[model samples]
Target: MLTKEAFNALLKTLEEPPENIKFFFATTEPQKVLPTIISRCQRFELKRISNELIIEKLSAISKDLEREIEKDALYQISNFSEGSLRDAQSLLDQIFCYSDGKITLEYVNNALGFIDPDFFFELDNQISKANTSFAFEFVNKVHSLGKDLSYIIEELIEHFKNLLIIKFNSKTSKFLSETILKKYVLSSALYQEEELFYILETLTQATILHKNYFKKIHLETVMLKIIKSKNVLSLDILVKKVN
Candidate 1:
């Protein structure tokens, strides 16, 4: 960020620039820049690079390097990189150095400290089945692996969000990988849409509280609340049950 004095100087330069000089400015937060400075320059918004394109580029890079990487691993890399191809390429370089043989999804997770999708799926299964023992066991496993509980809570929020999307509109599931899509298809059938929303709300609250003070026990408490939560039934369904 430029100081106010620097911005004033830049504004003056923009007003009367040297001959044959072109000024180009790029920023992710244009609103923070002085309005006068912005008025003197044209602005262009760049869209985030699509995950498919990122994956395609990563694949090309891997092939050129004569390194074998799994499609799912590439997908994970693309997601972690958000929309920056530079970050994606850098991550790929790091992973390439981390592994000697063909890179697998597990390898990517380990190298990046990312929780495996299987952990989410398994936790969801245990929660749906009300398997209290396995749910706690899952938490213990995550703790043993030194995973951040706050991050796990955030991921759980997204995991349930995906399930809700699958239940509401399977068509949009195209954003998910085939393996995860198949798992979501089966899992979505286990809960009503309302239940998924309830879980999202609960996890969101936990996330807020986690910022203040967090502990493994708090996570366990949240999981127990989720596991024992009553199914939210619509009035129509309630009336049907009454008859």
Candidate 2:
């Protein structure tokens, strides 16, 4: 029977507790409590429980599934949980329900399809479509997938690297699959191999810069600069800023 007025009375109780009495309080959001009350109480902040401890608790709770939950699958789930024991447990419960009491990587990936395959296709189509809106939409969709922008930049650089490699050597071409290699072989003809190599180098440097302190906005600008500069022949002259 804790009403607002009665709740305020707790301060009085706290100021002078009765003999042989004990009290404990808990709250998820402590900011709502008055500052004076908070100052008087001993604060105990709970740290995020480790993955190992979470597995221990889950093992204790479900002795039947202890061995299965203790494996690598739980570690992956804990990573996805972002350091919340309760969230990790909830994820494990959902996974158990869907996986028929077994945990596997395949089940985890299926549950979290955070990326789209069409992301590669849309970027590939950009050369032909030459549409600004499509480029913006595709880049934004990539950002929304919770992927690090640096990874996306690395993927693009690799794509262009494959194309450049295919362009330079016809016999070395067997490394690529028949379908994707064919596309690269065709696309490579548009630029000199030296020029393509320079662009690839620029992209690699940009990817490194992206990892350090550059914001997404600045990274995007640098990526666009590399893409637009594909027409330039001299790699040395283009990277004056880096020098």
**TM-score for each predicted model, relative to the true structure:** 0.91, 0.42
lDDT of 1 by residue, 1-243 (tens): 888889999999899999999988887777889988988888888888988999999999999999999988898888888888989999999888877899998998888887888877877777677776775787798899998887888778878999999999888865577877888888888887767877888888888545656578888888877775544565766887899
* Residue pairs with backbone atoms closer than 3 Å in model 1 (clashes): none
* Winning model by lDDT: 1
Task: Rate residue 5 of model 1 by lDDT.
Answer: 89
- What would the TM-score be for candidate 1 when compared with the true structure? 0.91
**lDDT string, candidate 2, 52-77, tens digits:** 67656666655666536434455456
Question: Can you tell me which runs of candidate 2 are displaced by over 4 Å?
Answer: 1-135, 235-243
Output the number of the TM-score-best candidate: 1
lDDT of each: 0.83, 0.62
